[model samples]
Target: MRYSKEHKNQTHARIVKRASVKLRERGAHGIGVADLMKEAGLTHGGFYAHFDSRDALVIEAVTHAMDRSTERWRKLSEETPPEKRLSKIVNSYLAPEHRDNPGQGCAVPALAAEIARESSKTRRVFSGRMEQMIDMLADQYPGLPRKAARKQAMAALATMMGSLVMARVTGNSELSDEILKSGRDAVLERAASSEKKPPRRAATSV
Candidate 1:
């Protein structure tokens, strides 16, 4: 039986949502179209109805994941004061809850490397999404010009992403926890340093 337009849209959303989580839990190439469709509670034959190819689904999935993450960041930051926004973001992202749950966590650390090696179309889409994330973070950083803030955002994100990767892969749980803490602390330090005013020269004694 043929589904209505609304039903088709819902099905398409379900497929993209499931694919988003699966792609993060497993790398970009780790999931196949058949498996994705199956997890989405649909038959493999319907996969082409939503997307032209597995790559198309992947692009949609990555965009969906990153957009969700950015929205979450905005929500979390909104609850905190302006000065503490970046700190709050860093801490929450590196928190144990996020670290232990890679499937629902940020896509940057999960699928970035694999996406890097994918087709140019995928890379361009991923790049654009990632830049949006960076630009969002850049705005939260204070005391810096826009260009400088963008650089700081890049550095902060790099540290957080690398630390998260190590934390996830390390054999010891204690080390994993430490890695998370260090990443949070490091980002907070970076934020603090950026906000520091220049030291003034002391007045000479007569």
Candidate 2:
């Protein structure tokens, strides 16, 4: 029996979802169509009906992972108090669990370097998703000007991504935690300093 259009869409979405996580865990090049399809609980033959080509599926998978991560952040942020949002985001993201399981974690840190060498279309999708994530993070600082908020987001994202990469590459767990803490403290301290600026005295005549 033929399934409805909605059923087809759901199946396709499932394929993308599974592929996205696999791509994150094992870089895009590491996974093949058959493996991804099998993981998605679909047959290899049905794959082509869902996507025009492997590239098309890759693009969709990237977007799917991005959306999942963003939704997770939103939920986490909402459940957490404002003051602890930064800590929550940083600590959880940099933890060993997230590092080891990129399949279920943020896409930027997981796949940014890999996606950079992909086609322009892939890069564009990655860029757009990153911008949205940064914007969400910037919104946490309502008091700061747009430029300042963007800068702060840049620091936080860069620190987290860089520290994670270093930690993973060195295969040193203690060093990884240290790197995470140092980066987190640096960004938080800078933000705190900005909040409590030193008072300016009246200029005295020389």
Point to the candidate with the largest TM-score.
Answer: 1
| Model 1 residue 160 CA deviation in Å | 0.6
Q: What TM-score would each prediction reach against the true structure?
A: 0.93, 0.89
Compute the lDDT of residue 7 as modeled in candidate 1. 98
Report clash pairs, candidate 1: none
lDDT of 1 by residue, 99-121 (tens): 88888999999988899899999
What is the C-alpha lDDT profile of model 2 across 47-150, one tens digit per residue?
A: 89899898898899999888887777788899999987877877777778776676787777778888988899999998998888888778766567798888
For lDDT, the strongest prediction is 1
- Segments of candidate 2 deviating more than 4 angstroms: 198-206
Q: After superposition, how far is residue 169 of candidate 1 from its true place, in Å?
A: 0.4
Q: Rate the local accuracy (lDDT) of all candidates.
A: 0.89, 0.81
